[model samples]
Target: MELFAALERDDYEELLFCQDKASGLKAIIAIHDTTLGPALGGTRMWTYASEEEAIIDALRLAKGMTYKNAVSGLNLGGGKTVIIGDPKKDKNEAMFRAFGRYIQGLNGRYITAEDVGTTEEDMNIIYEETDYVTGTSPSYGSSGNPSPATAYGVYQGMKAAAKAAFGTDSLEGRTVAVQGVGNVAFSLCKHLYEEGAQLIVTDINKEAVRRTVETYGAKAVDPADIISVDCDIYAPCALGATINDDSLPLIKAKVIAGAANNQLKEPRHGDALHGLGIVYAPDYVINAGGVINIADELNGYNKERAYKQVAKIYDSITRVLEISRTSGLPSYAAADHLAQERISMLKNSRSTFLRDGHHTLSRRQLRG
Candidate 1:
């Protein structure tokens, strides 16, 4: 299980990988850091095209988690695990247990939670093998799915973006185009519709498209067509990197915010967006609501606390937009600056005694 590292910034650490010969389960776990505390993130199951691609995803996702947690004011570092196989076809009880074994081996240097392709039952199976997972069934006293909370966060963040772009902080009567109508997007569409935003939606799944159309009276468009619909907000909830060079030219939205994991084809794409005057809510910052929910389990699961944390998504998005405007940078670059600022502050605030581990700093000294 040896490999090369991906192109990385100076802020991360590569961790463990496990491949089960018996079940053909391949998982790469990337832990960015444990400086703040234990690295907390999610297990994403997908059919990656190549090992390189999988590694790249794990690395990028893990780094994003670090920023996401830090800027969101969580005392958790970032780690991410990616299982290389189609969750719909390649997943089984044994396969998940194998992954659970991988987490068990980490000894809580990293923790796993729910993500795009993983479900509560999958977490349950992982639970069977390791005590390193969360976001499970309600019987397990966990939030079964974070879609609604995630959607609520996005809705709040979108409202913030709307306020930044327009004077009003409401979605009512705004034209919002949603690129996917999955569980979270479904709730998002309902929220938008309830607020009287005209909804334009697209999905490869016909049943989902029909359902969204029925539920929210959204106009259905092809995925390719969804991006250029000239809406007030463009939400790409399906996948990442939809805002690359070729497609970025056609985007007409004033605000770009969604639940997708990795939206930039490359870091420069952020700059390209900035040049075009699009207000982007960097993927990780806006989508941290789910991770925030799962991480809340560590603190006795207070709904009020979760709500407060989720509300930060709005502030975070607004800050990114503000930075982008003032610095003449893309929202992604602005977010990176903000994250780096927070991390640097954390490092600076640690007293010399605390840094050396010979003496301890008071909480006041640690709060710098």
Candidate 2:
């Protein structure tokens, strides 16, 4: 692969390849941008089919983080690290410690947290080497689990979307069809139930579906039937790309907001939603609560402060919808516009400041 060309295409700042023979660590770190501040993202460990695949995943995730952090109004850039191995059987203390040292080598330019296939325990190991890590055990001044915080953000974003689509943010009598009953979705269901929103839920895991049905009084449906269910909102909490061609025509929701990443199968799918007048709370923006909560750890980890910041996701989604209306763009494209606009504004401000600083220095030298 043309590595340099790949980085250039996306304006990636740096890509580091780390290896440790002793611990069998082979990792790639992709830093996509740093205009806002130091890059902050999570490290993911996966059993990728090939090195190229892992590299592509890291680059894609890093770019997504850039937009996620930008739209969430965090002073963080975007970067991601991927360890090429099976998380279940390949994790070891030495491996994480070696990885941590590599992160330390970058100074504070990159900060990492726990991601899929990586846990707080793994982050703790990384923490032992460098402090540029978040999502460690709560005993170490870290926010314990981010699931509830993420759920809260989604719920808030959903309300904003509902306001845009139904002219009322109140979900008291709304019908919400949830496609998964995972930790985050379960918490979201709790919020909706308390707000008097009837839930129709489904999951591949029968036990998970049963739990949601029992606790929140949600009606159980088959996973295949979730998209076509007669509901005001369809919350896809399980898999990515569910909004593809087959499901697009089947979706009956006025608003699509959930915890799943990459909800749109492709960019065009977003346009399809826009054509149908469906209000889509962009996945990364609505699901940024976990990252926001993790980011608060950089300021010494305050629960109240973290949650307060996460609650702003509602405003973020609202702003995205406004941008869509004003720009005549799909909600997904509007989200990208919002993030790019922020980054461009900051870049321009910095450029002007540097130019002014150079003039001041030149004048001072002449006087001297």
Candidate 3:
């Protein structure tokens, strides 16, 4: 890959390549932007097809963090680290410790958390080497599991999307079709159920489906039938790209809100949704509760503060919808605009402040 060109294209701030032969640690840390504050993102471990693939993934995920944090109103920038190895077989204390040292070298320009193929235990290992890490064990004052907080945020975002679609944000008596009854989705379903929303749930795991059905009195359906099911809202909590071409046409839901990442197969798909007048809560913005929860660790891990920030996702989604309505842009595009506007405002503010400071200093020197 043309590494410099790739970074330059996105105005990326920094990328670090760390290797430790002794522990077989091959990692790439990408810091996309730090205009907001220090970059904060997770450390993902994946067995990649090639080194180039790993680098590309790290860069992509890092830039995504920048947008996520910006839209979520977090005073942080975006960064990510990809460790190229088999998480199951290649993980060792030394490898994580070495990675932690590298993060420490950045002096908190980057903070690492647990991500795909990584666990809280791995985060604990990293904490041994530096304070620039989150998702550590609860014993370390880290927020334990992020699923419940994430679920609550999604529920709140869903209401915001519903308000944009329907006349009101109330989910009472509304039919909500939920795809994937996982940890986060289960909690989301509980919120929906308590609000008197009827649930139609589907999952590949029969046990999970049975559990949701029993717990929430939700009706179960085949996974293939989920997108086409008659419902007012479709909540995708499983995989990404469920909003692709095939599923888009089958969806009857007026509001699309979920905890999935990259719901739209592509950028154009988001435009398609806009054309259809479907209110979509952009995935990154709505699903940021997990990041918000972990980020609380930076300020000493106060649950109340973290959840309060997560609840703002409702306002964030509402802002995205308002921007779309006023600007005639797609919800996804509006989300991008929101993040860009925040970052640009800060950048411009700092530039003007510095320029004025220079002038004031020159005038003072002349008087002296």
What are the lDDT scores of the predictions, listed in order? 0.84, 0.92, 0.92
Count of residue pairs whose backbone atoms collide, per candidate: 0, 0, 0
- Best-first order by lDDT: 2, 3, 1
Compute the lDDT of residue 215 as modeled in candidate 2.
Answer: 97
- CA deviation > 4 Å runs, candidate 3: 47-50, 86-90, 203-207, 358-368
Model 1 residue 280 lDDT score: 81
Candidate 2: lDDT of 233?
98
Give the CA lDDT, 0 to 100, for residue 148 in model 1: 81
lDDT for each residue of candidate 2 in 1-368, tens digit (9 for 90 to 100): 99999999989999999999999999999999999988998888989999998998899889989999999989999999999999989889999999999999998889998876788889999999998898899999899777889999999999999999999999999999999888889999999999999999999999999999999999999999999999999998985789999999898899999998778888999999999999999999999999999999877999999999999999999999999988889999999988999999999988998888753343236769
Question: How well is each residue in 121-228 modelled by candidate 3, as lDDT tens digits?
Answer: 999889999998988889988997677888999999999999999979999999999999988899999999999999999999899999999999999999999999
RMSD of each: 3.3, 4.1, 4.4
Candidate order by decreasing TM-score: 1, 2, 3
**lDDT by residue (tens digit), candidate 1, 107-215:** 8788888887898889999999988788887787776788888888888888888888887888888899999899999988888999999999999999999999998
